[model samples]
Target chain A: MSEHGTTLNIEKFGSASEAKALSAEADDWTLIIRPQTGWFDLHLADLWRYRDLVTMFVRRDFVSFYKQTVLGPLWFVLQPLLTTLTFTIIFGNLAKISTDGLPKILFYMSGITAWNYFGECLTKTSDTFNANASIFGKVYFPRLSVPISIVISNLIKFAIQFGLFLVFYFYFLFRGSNIQPNSMLLMLPVLLLLMAGLGLGSGIIVSSLTTRYRDLRFLVQFGTQLLMYSTPVIFPLSSIPEQYRWIMIANPMTPLIETFRYAFLGTGTVSWGMLGYSAVATLVIMTVGILLFNRVEKTFMDTV
Target chain B: MSETVIQVRDLSKRYRLGVIGGRRLVDDINSSMARLLGRQDPLAKVDLLPGADKQKAARSDEMWALQNVSFDVEKGAVIGIIGRNGAGKSTLLKILSRVTAPTTGEVRVKGRIASLLEVGTGFHPELTGRENVFLNGAIYGMTKAEIRDRFDEIVEFSGFEKYIDTPVKRYSSGMWVRLAFAVAAHLDPEILIVDEVLAVGDAAFQERCLGKMEKVAGDGRTVLLVSHNMSTIQQICKECIMLKNGSIHKVGAPGSVVSEYLSETRVATNVDLTQWQDRTGNGFAKLSRMAFLNADGEEAGIFPIGTTICFDLETTYNRELIDPLFEVIIHDPAGEPLMHLRSEHDGLRIGKVNGRTSVRARVDNVGLYPGRYFVSARIAAGGRNVDFPRLCGSFQVTPSPGRHGDLRLNPKWGKYHLDSTWTRGDQ
Candidate 1:
């Protein structure tokens, strides 16, 4: 431990107001910075000092968006509900995409619900610097708190949407829509965690890059759109042709979507090998993302 | 006794001027592919040396924002950081506030810190002022309960009672600044750092903020303030640090540091305005130059408070134009306008001229704060035109022998300076 040196002897005199009045009366104004060797450096105490500020920023991100809307918190549920309806109409009915003979709404809703969480997190994380540069420039809090808050706030939205899926799932079961809860459903939390980790990880990585080239900004939207095709979002994993099955299975999201559908409908394929692969991929990507994010947050202002 | 809460050791931050570094998707893919084959990084085979600069045009040139800087801040000490533009004062404060990290060296500190590098900085424009206050407070590290406790005070301090529910985007710039400052000052933190935010808001608000900062510091908290206003800095800060370029030029007693800063960056009395090449507007009704003539009618460098003065402006009108409006705006050294003089309402035309024209304005008395000031003159061929070349020059106003604070006008028993007298009569 370092020994403390150069303690300032603060003479407890009067109230701050009294001191201010006395200073004004004395008519002596001064600006002082102690000449030393370590002014422009990182200070953890500063970040700890501003922890409350980080929390406030997190709350702001969470609450401000839905404050004025008519549906209010219900908007969260409505988002995935509407998206699930669209996917059911497009993939289940028109395209005749197979859901392994499960209820159309239930199959598509489960996939969309999980997929939406990842998409939202990734998109939000990718735009972190560009979206909040003005705020970041003006105040000093933990820079990571911004992206971290984005993930947390989006989690709340995901929870609400997920709850809506649950409600609809029970409705379909009650209506005899060929759905039954399975043992795989118990792993829902783990699958959701994987989705969040991968989305947040990739989002922050791209966000760090988008601050510089901005070319990635366009690619993020395009790539997300293309990446959706590779995942088992619309069609079941079994629908892929035999030769291309390995390529589809190689996607990190494949196990999440498959396990999610298998949990509720008990029809889609679920494999421990695929889940383990995704877990490894999630860990690797998250490590890379955090390292890159930590490095970028230090000097992104220069490039951004 | 106040303990040294923050210790920085040989900290320096260097930034690339125009470049990019780090891995791209291709790099990541290639690295992963190489690792699959048990090989070294593919790009490492090319630019393996530390000084290698020929690899890419993206990651070459750089500049140092903070170089070899060091300091220790004792708890409860209100230190002011000051410098001219681009002196790295903000950068130093930002680093201390932990918004960014230094490229070299380390910092050790104790306790919580909240920095308002800018007012209303973290505000979401779409959110109401009420929502923003909570959000901004949270960002500053306040708990929801803490924000709730201080919520009323923040709102009342801003004096935006009726507009609290309004989205911050709709609030005036003044309201925005006041609200932002209120949130920052009210956050109960062990260390508070602010950067030149006092320049916002009216005089009374600035005074109130200074008082609040004093109160915070008095409560055994550390404060780091960066501002250009010497008087404000001197009033609020006990010690001062003067930065030049990217390093500390001087530090210690605020009075001495401020004086040194002023002397080093001060514009010479005999400054030639003609050499400034950045003046806007073309030669068409262009203002070539401007100067301040003293009470003795001699061209002078400095003005005293409440001195009668004349502004001599030379303009080159290239087109045959009708009535042209000529105006002169006087701004304090910090770029705050003190007064603006214009040909009242109608345009003052030096009609149909293709040659140079000189104009003059005689004022009874010019009252201004004791500091350097800038004179920006404009000559528009017609009313409501600002694109024409305007004359802009800066001048200094030395503090009067007996005067104080920002405003120069002396008043007699009035709330504001309005050139009036008050008498106590039977109410």
Candidate 2:
């Protein structure tokens, strides 16, 4: 029997815990029945034990998107590929946007891959309250599972795009194109991390806000498009004039996108210090996002 | 001794009833601006305090959906939470299930909780029924293998095998509810919370659901049920809790709690609409009040099934009323209409009753089940008529020991035959 049960043993305790404890005490699950006062004092251990639920949510998100469509999961790859081609033709040729000496197709494809992950994460997370209000009002699961699952689900789209990016990289190399490798390639994971963190953080924050103001819901779609322009998705970071460079650097996503391009093509500028600042900023945003989300999860149904 | 699985203390939830319009936006912005200045806003002051029911007097301000509610459930206890509309029964379940937080107080629960608050709420409309079963079960925290083990059970329970591969949107509403309920009931959880979702299905399905709930209760799992159906509550719940105006009115054995609820709500000879002042509808003829008189011509709140009664109804029309036909319907607690009487069938009509008029209906043998019933009246002129409006009356038909089989009188011609002259000629 567990210590808590033994302390209040008016009746004989079940041997379920004792039997498991005999083999390995570490392996035995602990059930805590705490009287929590507010949202700040959540039972984290219980949430941890139910991590499988988070996984299931992610699976549901991924599978349901492609279940009935004729093209199915292939749309995951095609969506980004088509967007990259459109940007290449319009921004690269017609508008003549600077790609910083890299091939137009590769530059736009890389940006689309990173940007799509963030955009999907933000849009999905922002709409969480409105989309799942019906279910959230009925069941009791760790609400964090929802945003976490969104991030994971969007990763599938990113992975498919990444595969296309790899194909383009190999094709450029086989065509005898001049692309050199640098130590900055090691920073790709960090860039991906920053993108994921920023999207999830910003998404959850806006999602919570939209539950109340509802005006935020209207802004979410338009705001995401405007936000893309502020980031160096189609243009090189170096093209920004000196006076506006500081503003671009402070955008956080600027350093992230710059580092990703520099690592892949060895053409754009890479600043380790700027990348470090962006990473720290992403972490801070995610923490605040989580806090706001926790508070909102408790009362969202009332407002929703 | 049975284990105690859930303990609740002083749980209450307050909901703000904001006005529906652009004015609400101004209040919201003003509150945020006031907070920026480190000052309290005028609109924030409208928040209802915990345990306050006075806030409901105004329709625009916040309402305390739940107030000072407290109860505990023993392990394996099947508790029915009963109340009138807006009594906070659903809010209480939401709090217990952790879907929403209480404004004040705490709940200590032991074991994994599963709430069927809305059957198949997690289901995707475009997904196949089979796919939804797995998806919903997984969302409820069951493992894929666990769902696989229960898949056949779920399919059988829903009885939707023919359409299992079809998308849920294509299924009929009843089939959707059945599939949703099937997934919820099959997932074994230590504590099960169910709302009034079972009312969506047909009679046989409802009976089957009741049987399933009984079986779940018998398995030593804790169950919290919120429902308006008193008969279902009495059948399945050993204990009951009564909520009134967002507060705990009573909690104990099912019989006592239900009876207390009935007695507390018992009206005299006349029905009062003053308490239910708030009304919802386009302006038409409205039922303001009603009454039922006993043999002594005194107001009788309750009566036996066989008792003769005089039902008096008062209604006010918003527009012209001419050649109005009135109808009264009596429904059981399950919302199944037991008896219907229309004034037109009996050649009873009022010509051009334009204003408020008290119409009296003399009824004989008002056969009813031994439960609470709602009486609604409708008035119509020609083809167009007022929606069933002014008949907000509830009455109880006390159970009689002598009436064994059914509540209604079953007439027979065995002993009371007067014309017996040719009875021997047939032989």
> What is candidate 2's lDDT per residue for B1-427, written digit by digit as tens?
4444665666667676663221344567888899899998767544344443343434336666776555556678899999877788888887877778888766767777888877787877777898888778877878778889999999998887899999888988888888988898897888888887776577777777888899999998888888878877888998888877777766778999888877867764576653554344444677667787876777888877667677787878787778777777876666666667787888876877767887777776655545687776666667665656433677777755434443332221111112123346767
Q: DockQ, in order, for the candidates?
A: 0.21, 0.23
Which parts of model 1 have CA positions greater than 4 angstroms off? A1-59, A68-82, B1-3, B6-9, B20-61, B105-107, B125-131, B148-177, B264-288, B295-297, B306-308, B316-322, B343-348, B355-357, B384-392, B399-427
Best by DockQ: 2
> What are the fnat scores of the candidates, in the order listed?
0.24, 0.26
**What is the per-residue lDDT of model 1 for residues A1-304, given as tens digits with 9 covering 90 to 100?**
0011112212222244554454355422121222222323333464565566656655677666776677789878877778778988887888888888988888888888888888888998889888887767666566767676777788888888888888988898898887778888779889888998999889989987776556678899889878888999889999989899999888898888888888888787788999999999999888788777766676676664
Model 2 alpha-carbon drift over 4 Å, by segment: A1-47, A67-82, A181-183, B18-29, B32-62, B160-162, B274-281, B294-298, B381-385, B400-427
What's the true lDDT of residue A211 in model 1?
A: 68
Clashes of each: 28, 3
lDDT of 1: 0.72
For candidate 1, the per-residue lDDT at B316 reads: 63
Clashing pairs in 2: B3-B75, B269-B299, B287-B390
